[model samples]
Target chain A: MRKLPELNAAGNKIPNRQAICETLMEAAGRDRNVVALCSDSRGSASMTPFFEAFPEQSIEVGIAEQNLVGISAGLAKCGKKPYAFSPACFLSTRSYEQAKIDCAYSDTNVKLIGISGGVSYGALGMSHHSAQDIAAMSAIPNMRVYLPSDRHQTRKLIEALLEDEKCAYVRVGRNPVEDIYSEDDCPFEMDRATILADSEEYDAAIIACGEMVRPAVEAAKLLKNDGIRAAVVDMYCVKPIDREAVLTAARRAKLIVTAEEHAPFGGLGSMVSQIAAAECPRRVINLALPDAPVVTGNSREVFETYGLNAAGIAAAVRGAEEFL
Target chain B: MADHDRTDNVMKDHKMTNSELALLSCRLREQTVDVITGAKTGHIGGDMSVMDILVMLYFRHMNISPANMDDPDRDKFVLSKGHSVESYYTVLAEKGFFDFEAYKNSFSRYGSEFIGHPHNTIPGVEMNSGSLGHGLPVCVGMALAGKMDGAPYRVFTVMGDGELAEGSVWEGAMAAGHYHLDNLCAVVDRNGLQISGRTEDVMSHEPLADRFAAFGWHVIECDGHDMDSLDAAFREAEAFRGMPSVVIAHTVKGCGSSVMEDKAAWHHKVPNAEEAAQIRADLEERKEACRHA
Candidate 1:
């Protein structure tokens, strides 16, 4: 097993759910046409501020996920920018047909913000966990999927998507996440991959996305200690993936390993395999959740149990060394 | 006369006689039956039931220009009972939205834009609707937009009696009433039969008119096949203000065909070649009778 790097300090003063609500409310305050459609998840989605700020623009569809999406599509058709907020599990699964037809197929300007993504509702069981959203969203044709790494990225992505008149889904975490960047960092672009770390003579590339990016950065530091340089790439946009960056990494590195907190099918790894098979099909190993329901535990416990931490990712990268 | 004056005079005299309009509706019904039989699949019963309603809207009520389909100010018509898209395509083609020949070969060859339901892939269709409950909300949205923009275009949608089972219809109804969309009119094709059986046997919507009235709409009832009654109801719908209107058109399923009329089995059953020929002949006889009347 490869040695893991020291984890980043926890308890950083990051933005909580209330902060996200306040930011959305501020955006609504600035634009009268900005509307938020929620499916009986206003309090959980932290949309009270938005509801108070713009009562007329806020629509509570009351547990009807299909109607939530259809009405948003209708509103978007009439030239209103609507953000449909719901629990990640139901929004991506129950009303999936609506997402495909009303938003993706119709090309409606509706931003689907799936709150409480992944195992954020850890102890609440698998019903609330949303580990399959990325896999589901990546298969859609015109949908742009964004899983922001932290609050700063989330705010920037929200701002950019507000201006973009296309269908998009943003998978946001429930708990406060560590700030990944300073205020001066450039705004998030849909198609570009952010490179957090790089070495001149890296033997392998450890591509990570979403919440897994922080761990991959730590794992890269551990790989350096073992006399192996690992490059870390943050692939945020999973649908229209940054193929150019992926191909460059595949050509330069001896081995490529992808890490995501999602299923192996139709996730970041599956996306990479499609490109690497046609471009550079050498040894591409995918590190993702297995094909089963995730076990019950807290978020950290679940991540550790499923081998999605820094140690697991570093070990997977080292396992690819046999091919090189 | 000068050329321009002659053209203006021809345009002024472009009105159709009642017999001609009846013949057009008969042609629409025959074409609907023909395409459904040709494809070996379609909703024929509902199509026949709503033929006259569609005829009234397309020929007389709606100010649609087949030449310029995307004209923003044109009156909007939505087939809320989307299972009957065969009727819509027939009427639209007869009204010259596309070549009449195109619909004759519909739903057979690959890549043909004419699918079972109304899709935006077809040029003249406004919304891609096949799901029973989607059309009314979308129509409400369009009507609300018209109200907001102060556009003088009326919005009309036809819902089936069975489609009233969907709760989204009531949601749209409440919204339309709340907004006071007087420029909107919804015509319910009360054919009384759905896919399974009679609507009353399946899920009773007996008090449908009262339901719409309680939801704050000006409710009107008429025999759907009576052109005079349909014309009056439409005229009243247009005159009403500050509230949306609902015209509950009582119609028999499969109206023209005697054996199939009011029969639920013909909801989607395609006719054999002999039956198709007989139905065509019967429609032709009806057309001749109307001309004589």
Candidate 2:
């Protein structure tokens, strides 16, 4: 684990998907058992370099997500660590049964990498978006769900997963946003939330995951500028959620705002609210994409429309008085 | 030689005769019927139909055993027609993988590891499969792993003809051929019936051989109930390199019984006491004829 960079100086952004590909390529270079499988999405996943480097360790299933997962699970059974990469919308829903039964239930060490997750396929419209993946992947028993906020955290998460013999799902965004952590200084831990902001007199805690984490930190800054302190958390481990962190965030502030690029029902918001309502009852304003087909545009435009940006979050925090 | 090396020698050194394998199937079919009758729930029809194929693989061919389970080079098998797990349980138990009584007493009961569908938690079961179309793709993976490692292990799976209707089966079929996985052999129990009706009525997988052939699979058709035919089909599959192989085993739904034979109701129907007696009698007659013949 490295020290986190100053929240104000986040710079030199890299796509989390690229980080996953590079890290997997490096791992496969060292260990022959590390395999990268794709459903004809190597170019989209930025994994063509890995495939080129270790042709033996790369499998192109050619647009079949179900077979991609099933074959990955099969390879896992043969003592291979197969990382099955596919687009989130099809992989999570289309190959869902394969993940549940073949990988998780069968206890195969297949890592499901859902790239272009959430609304990251912004202009491709709802058919290509995966607003329900977090909920779907988390529902499977023995499946560990992860949504790393940036390149550094994605590296940490992949490296940690490589060490364990288990079934896991890793969801990463398509585009590179401004770095939330400087390349030199990103603290990392397996299955634990990264707290970006904490203050004794904080007014709210905005907990987020995947592409939404940086905006959350920015939201904390906006609130701080208005003489209001707020805590920000990167809840990367969505399945085995950081309960203690959610509890602490509940304790640090009066209002808890959960932000994500996923749907409202079964994502980060529902999880935080469930935990807060049970252990530490607090007001949770879950800001997520609506249940309906969201407006089509680029990711930024969609985020802005859904009130998932810094200003929207800051305004939500400022309007927290209505519930109080 | 080491214990495993000796076991390997023993396995290679002594393959069972086709008649002996047939006798073993006769007994296992009886056992399969007993459990499904006692439990009052199972896919008994397909179990009887696929019994000889499973027997031939475990007894005569396929280098998998309870002793050599830790051997990475040993062949992997999955009952893709997983509802037929009752017979698989009997086969593995008979092969000395685990205690028969444990599975006999508590199968499908709460907390019992003898789950209705086969899961890897049990000895000798490679993949947890109940949903159709899952096993073949998984086997394709296993075979591909062996091909990648240049390992001498093969992957085998049995699917019901009805299971071929699942689009994922075709997806797996394409991959098995596309990857040129010669180490994979799939046997379809073409018993001609599913739960609802004859497979053609429900969903036609006819021209099934052509279907698989179109996907680039080398298809072999054989009489499923005959041990020698299964042996020949499997042997041919093993020798056919550079592509995956499929044995389209034509079998009767309830192979060893007059009461259940060709009956779709027996797919999940439990036998009454009278029905069990008749089925057991028929099996005994078949066993005597099999041993003598």
Candidate 3:
């Protein structure tokens, strides 16, 4: 196996929430029609900067998630591109019917930004954790789901959404996260997945999304140390999963292991498995949160306890080789 | 006749007879019921309840041009109580927005744009709506945009009395009042019934006009089926400034149909051949009575 380098030993400098708020404010400053609607979560969603900077563009619906989406759809219909921000859990579950009818079914250009997604709100309990946001959002047709790897990717994704007219749900992290890409690589395509690690010949491919991408990178190095060459692909755009890249990886590799910090059903793993079953039928293994409610702990400890860390991913990748 | 001659010259230019407008309203409602019964599926209860409001808005109240639907300065209308799309589609067809034939084949074939609700695919449809309680907030946004852009276009939306139970409707109500959308008007079809049972039994929205008044909207109560009252309520809405307006249109659940009137079962019932024939005969009798009157 290849020697794995320490991940973010120096620690993260930028908070993901502030980074997203700044990106939204920057976009609002440039466009007059750009507006932000929140469900009494301007502080929690880190939209205070936007509220202060573009007060005219900020609309606070006061704890009304359904109206938050409905008003945003109305604003979008009237030639405004609106960002509807709220806690991921409530935004995904509480106003799900409105999200389906007002935004997706109506084909409104509304960006649904779900803040503090996927256990990022650790210790606040499972009620706050947005583990099922991906699954819930993916079921709605015409909605593009994006789970960015880090602050940089989140900012890039926000910029990309300003030009994208389709309905989108961006699952944003709350806490500080290590940057996965360089500052120079500021722009990324919505449909393209970034290749963090790869080799000419690989026995297995490690496909990961969102917070799991960093671990997949570490898992790739660990596999290489044990004389196993594993490729890593960051599947950021979960809905329109990069079919070409996933198929290529499956054809070239002996086994494909998908990982995510989300529910196993209808998530990145399930999405990749469906692709593999149809195009490149290969032995696929999925590492994800189970169907039941997750236990309470700090984000890192819970991930490790649930076997969702780099070690768990590497172990799953190695186990899939038996079928190959 | 010197005083009468002087009044005639002054009033002739602005005078509009309610009989002519009422006949049109009756025709619009009859067509709405006929199409729904023919298609064998639709929300006939709410459609009958809101028909007069729709006719009044389309014929005499709102400044809309069927030939110029996309005109930037045209007034906007949102049917928030979207299950009652039968009335909206019939009025739009009669206004020449699209062919009445299209309304005849609604919800029949696959890929038919005219589904059970208002969709953007249909001409003159502002927003695709079927989900209850979504129309008001969207109308608020449109009204706010018109005010911001210095446009004279007004926005009107219809809400079901039952839908007022939704918290989102109240949220939108607060926003519209807070924004001081004087150019915005909302009408509630207070038919007193919903799908399961009477609105009061299902979930009461009693003192509904008081709720709008409490929300800071200029509240007006009127008979939804009366063309004169509808016209008067709309005029009151237009005259008001610095606050949104709500016309609580008291109406029967199934107006105009003797058998279906005030019946909740007709909310989604497909009229059988015998019932349909009876309804057609009643409509023809009403038409002839109007001609003689």
The global C-alpha lDDT for each of the candidates, from Candidate 1 onward, is 0.78, 0.89, 0.81
Top-scoring candidate (lDDT):
2
Model 2, stretches more than 4 Å misplaced? A1-13, A322-324, B1-14
Candidate 3 lDDT over B140-224, as tens digits, reads: 8788767666766778999998898888899889988888888789999999999988999998887787888888899999988
lDDT for each residue of candidate 1 in A1-324, tens digit (9 for 90 to 100): 122223447765654345556667777788767888788898888887788778877877677676677667766766678889998888898767667766787677888888888888888977888878988886788888987776766777677787789988888777776655546663456677876545554678877777887777777888778877787777877767889878877877788889887877888998888899998875788888777778888767877887788898888877777755
DockQ for all candidate structures vs. native: 0.28, 0.87, 0.58
Per residue, candidate 3 scores C-alpha lDDT tens digits across A180-225 of 6656654377788875544665788888888887778888888878
DockQ of candidate 1, scored on C-alphas against the true complex (2 decimals): 0.28
lDDT of 2 by residue, A1-324 (tens): 112234655455568888888888889889999999999999989999999999999999999999999999999999999999999999999999999999999999999999988888888899999999999989999998999988888888999999999999989888886777756777778898987664554678889998888888888878778878788888999989999989988987889999999999999999999999999999999999999898989899999999999999888999987643
Candidate 1's displacement at residue A192, Å, is 2.7
C-alpha root-mean-square deviation, each candidate: 5.5, 2.4, 4.6
lDDT for B287 (candidate 2): 97
Q: Indicate which candidate wins on TM-score.
A: 2
Candidate 2: tens digits of C-alpha lDDT, residues B101-203: 7887788877889989898889999889999999999999999898888888878999999898898898999999998988899999999999998999999
TM-score of every prediction relative to native = 0.85, 0.97, 0.93
Count of residue pairs whose backbone atoms collide, per candidate: 0, 0, 6
User: Lowest-scoring 10 consecutive residues by lDDT in candidate 1 chain A?
Assistant: A1-10
